[model samples]
Target: MSGTSEGQGPAGVAVPGSIRPSVTERHNFGRTASELRDYRAAFNAAQLAMAVVDHRGLVISANEALAALLGTRPTELRDRYAADLIDLASDARTWHAYREVLRGRRSRFRCTRRLKHPDGRALWAEVTVSPVPESGTVLLSVADISDRRELRARLRHLQMHDPVTRLPNRTLFFERLTAALESSPYDQGSTGRIGLCYLDLDGFKAVNDTLGHRVGDRLLAAVATRLAECADAGGPGHGGGHLVARLGGDEFAILVEDSTGTEQLADLARSVLAALQEPFDLAGQRLSVSASIGVVERAVSGTSATGLMQAADTTLYWAKEDGKSRWTLFDPERNAHRMTRQALSSMLRPAVERGEFTLEYQPLVGMADGVTRGVEALVRWNHPQFGTLTPNRFVAIAEEDGSIVQLGQWVLRTACRQARQWQLDHPDVPPLFVSVNVAVRQVWDSDLVADVAEILAETGLPAHLLQLELTESAVMGSAGRPLQALQALSDMGVHIAIDDFGTGYSNLAYLSRLPVSVLKLDGTFVRGFQDEAHANPADETIVQALVELAHRLGLTVTAECVETSGQASRLRRIGCDTGQGWLYSRAVGPDRIAEMLGAGPRPQAAAASG
Candidate 1:
């Protein structure tokens, strides 16, 4: 049989006479033998285990790779049943599956199996077994995937936990939430609901700025632990379960499943607030932080994961805005208003370009002579959809979106042009100074002096007639270059007034050094004069002191919010040089302002009293 050729066989050999094998058939057998030898060599060299088992499930041959994989020698493994290697007590089903392959019911099998190595180390392998009927042997291959498994575990850790706080992130929180929502003893009604407590750490930015980020990170980790403890205190029995997560940057979220009502959620929010009230010692420095919480409980109906998240976000903003260290619930009306504001803010730049904005001038009256000294240029938006909108509605949004730079430029040019027109029309009225408010970002980002100089030059208006009103905070916050910029504007003869005084960190020493000529007292101080008789004497004394101080520094004092003749009289007695508010007139159009100036200082007691 060994010497048999494709076309002839040995004389004594019992050959099948009807079959005639060709040269290709003989070459095919040789190629098959060579390929099998190569496969066996490669398999023996592999780090994974390899073996060939007979039809009776007895190992016919084993490779060095298999011996190394099993931590034993190849000779000891010969003729052993493959099933004997696996820990049968833990994986009986896998052995049965291998038997099915031997029974011809299955051609292949794959499973994760555990085996004890010769060194007694427990090992895991992903095994594959395939039947080779032509050879009457079954092939088995195994690869150790422990490192890959560990890598997957590490990736899961990073995805589910916060790096800084070591707290569960939103992914793990939502996973737990879904499990709790699906668990037994769900909410009582058809409309089952869950509650979320969203919290933002108040004054955390101050801590991060004062201390370094390392201390801040340590403080956040400590806070996370405290929050977890609080959640554990109100665990499963109270409602269902409470899961806390760090939702990035001083913000945290808590998921309370099967909440009976908002009351339970409120209690949890208060507990978290109380938990955070305790001071944290980080890097030998003691720091205190407070959290503002937003609680929302919703029936599973009409709610989705994204909607719930958005609701929490909106409520969180409300919590921060309505004074920190407090909690607010989601309100449909408030959310609608926020949506509208968002829409308006998004549309503001396009609105300006489309000519939706118009200027209205409010008279700044001289208290001594009852004459309209100047008109403060105020911006009003005539929205196509929402109608007339005031500066209070969109100015801050503009500043935040960086649209204020363009808006400020528009205001400057418009006011200067109008002031130039007013000067031409009312030559009798002492050259009206059109005051426009300047935003801090605009001052920082733009060449404000050049902008003003260009506007004055283009409009042919005197620089002194165009006053720029900068808030006290905005002025004082300016650094070296911004200070120089203000000085440059002052050098160009553009009068600068500190608007909304007494509201910020009022460093009178710094105030005396700014290149400003006018001090506009904030309305709060003027409103105090209305109730001075019943109010603290110190209030009146402070107003008098401010007036004396401004006069002593050669600065003009303008009293704001002179609503009535009585308030105006008190302001005049305090020696306030000018008054601006509802007393003389509300802000009117440029045409109306021209008419008022032409009407020859209409005598009004409120204006004269100041």
Candidate 2:
């Protein structure tokens, strides 16, 4: 090897020969010539491939190990550009770093590079370059890391895949999804939008339970095969393929980068659903299955992986709710409504505790005399954020979260106390009964009989004057605990009125056996009797039959939603015992009820005026 005697230091300044270190001082540590020969022999025999390269980036000398590693003779490597020999100029960054080391501007340069041996086998090599002391030359070292690299690759494959189905798992799915979202808009061939289809097999748990996991595993593998095929066929417009991943259990996801639009995602979702519809002939079990898919597609600029996934999950739930075996697209309006419902549901228990609820009473008047018979208690929520909300807005939410039990207790206690107050305040007028609506969950979840007994006792109100109204569907199926509760409450003299009657099972025979005392006809039947000329005889006939049946079963009938005088007159002619609706007055405060009780029957125009 030959080189200039003048060397360049790390500052890129040339060092004169007089100041440069001697070969004996740097390489042999001031040893004799024979020891220097021994050092050369050791360098040649060393296992790590090594080379000497001048400031010009030309290889001056190569050790036997380097020659063997490169599958070339030492003579062939001599005078070759070190950068070309190890493919250092493959990328701009690595090339610039190598130049920095050659120009004495960098202390050292190290990087991993893929090298092709003369025998045509690829090997991953860790290449490092450091300056040789005072020689204006650099010592280059190469270590074989292919084995380590291969091991890491294998471990990553196993970590990112499902063992049973051999598909990408949730970890890899999230990784790819995050990468897609994070990709720069300026990237070559980049698309500004993305899409995903998230789905799960319907009735998969039943399959696992009935057929055992072994069979279920086979079915999953079969499903995965079909899903992969669907992904391939439904790839993005850029020819970049869709990524199909199993997100645990029967749930899977297909992500499309550079997505075209919603139509593309919808097509993919439909294809997946269609593919899964076919029967899986696993081990002669012949299992059939379907999937509910949620398809979401939008510009990637404003969304994150988590937000996109949440939208997809919500859409998928809607698909299942609309009935499985279908795909649902994400609708912003529907999502907003869902968000509102969720907001309401989350605040339900707190609202009850905050005393955000109040009661209004609608008059249930006698059909024959048009006189006030009793007042039905209707609950209202004065939401701080949403203003006033009727029961329809939040009752189902409370029922789902079991907050209805607490809310119902409040309504019961408040209504009984108010009824007792009204009874005492208006001793001259007939005592007005306050009827409260009860949810079926209130009966099953709480000691309904005990709750009512306690409230009536605490409020000093007679049970006979406090009517408990339940929907027809709830009471018709009464048995076990519910049936016992109803009988006990009835025996205590509290009237059991079936609200929205003739809309449910309308089990007339069952009604005769239960302890029910009153039937409130559904509004749909009364809406038909809005005016005399428009009255449908069929509706009147159904109402009259239901009324006659109730009368025979020793129960009174209350016509609900009586909106006009004509309807009230017909209801009176039909012998409907009591009427409840806006024809008298919309549900109002206790003061209005007191006014009604003091003023005789309400005039025809009085309700309209209110």
Candidate 3:
């Protein structure tokens, strides 16, 4: 007690002359033997594990709590290195801090350390070491944080994994993908390339609709298990550390680390398909599912996690388009084209407002007399960036985006206006009917008869001279409101022609019930006329039968895509009432149509050879 200047180590060991002792400190240290007994009793009652260690990092003494926490007797803890109790490598920064304490540079140090208890339990300890400077001793305080750490680990697991499939969720997958991409080499070095296989199950929605979501969930779990197994197998070419993640719903992805090349990824894609070939037993129903995969591979540089995922999504759509249960690799050129299409889709509504759309006419010629009876109005988009784009490029997009009705109305009104203009321009000649193509969407969206009546009235064109051309399926499937609309349009003296006939499955019996007047033979039938007069006659025979059937049903037949003289001659011979195609000329503007009308019917040889 007399040698003590300030502070005490474990069990009141005095550090002599560490600091200048005040009179109050000396009086506090000068406790009787009974007071010292009270201090020892309080130390034994403490809950935190504590110890005193000498300058060499050796334990000098310990309390009962310290002994109990280590699962050892208090006497057995004495005379041991304090570093031995707090598990860490010798070269750790905390050890350097410990040296700083011993060198008198630091008064105290605190850090996290792992500890092994005598009973083989692992402990996470928050250890505080305070120096008793002059005595070359330190007081150590340890608190067990194992439960908190365990809870945090559980929470983190829940955050990063899917609840249904227990696979890495999108959040975690993105994190890992970003890390991999950042760490990988710019080129295909030994550090390895990165490959991602993004897959979506085909017909998964059908399973959800039929078997219920419970079955669908079980199916997803089974799929995830198989994918995880495949990834974990990591055989010769599969590489290592592949991450399997459930992106959501029926979609999943595999991140291949250290990927060698596309060949390796291709092998993995095949494995995935092969694995999913087996049936999944879900809710007492055996369900078979297939997947379409988009494979994208690149070196680490110039690619981000989001960009990789976007590329994967784009290629996955391509795989689905190419037919399901297949893999499509990322092609930059195709991706660029698809991006252009998407840009076009976004621009459609504005383009309609911008007046970028225009109509061209293709003459529907009377086959027998070689006279131009009507011109089919074909819509074209004069895109600002891209030149005139054909219907083949943008029609489907308009239909998909619900812009078809708007575009259809525009075409109808414009064609009707053009027809009125033509009649005004040529009152002395026969009225040339202008046919406008009507989309299936345009018919079902609203009252078609009202729209057509309005267009005819607005343009001052007679309904009889304005023919509405619908695809054959639309006519055959017309029902309820659509059927009534078609009947009303027919009653209003608007001619209804079924376009692209024989291309779709048409119920011939329903053709008589429809208010349709003209049927256009699909181009497939006319293309067969290329091989002499007799050789591949299947298409020609089909065309002849369709024409005869139409005639019996009192519907006039028009042949489309008659690009050659032989096709024109065969169509004319088959009794096709009208022929419209490039054989006469490609679709031209209204001025050209007026010129053709002004020229009147040409000679038969001129019609065929021209």
Best by TM-score: 2
Q: Pick the candidate with the highest lDDT.
A: 2
Model 3 scores a C-alpha lDDT of 0.85
What TM-score against the true fold does each predicted structure earn? 0.63, 0.89, 0.78
Cα deviation at 14, candidate 1, in Å, is 35
Model 3: weakest 10-residue lDDT segment is 600-609
> Cα miss at 216, model 2 (Å)?
1.1
lDDT of 3 by residue, 1-610 (tens): 3454565643565645656658885666565545878967777778988987877777878999899888888889888888777763355797889877766689988888777877898888898888875777788889888999999999999999999999999999999988887773644444457899999999999988988898888899999999988887763444446899999988999998777789878988998999999888876788788999999998767888889989999999999999999999999999988888899999998898899999999888888887788888999999999999999999999988889888888889999999999899876567789988888888777567888888888999998998998888778888988888888989999999988888887788889889999998888778778848454777777777888898998989988888888878877887999898888879899998888766754454355556
Candidate 2 Cα RMSD (Å): 6.1
Candidates in order: C-alpha RMSD to true structure = 9.6, 6.1, 6.2
Worst 10 residues of 2 by lDDT: 600-609
Q: What is the lDDT of residue 435 in candidate 2?
A: 91
Candidate 2's displacement at residue 304, Å, is 1.5
Where in model 3 is the C-alpha error above 4 Å?
1-109, 114-123, 129-151, 158-166, 169-171, 186-191, 199-222, 235-240, 247-251, 280-294, 313-334, 531-535, 595-610
Ranking by lDDT: 2, 3, 1
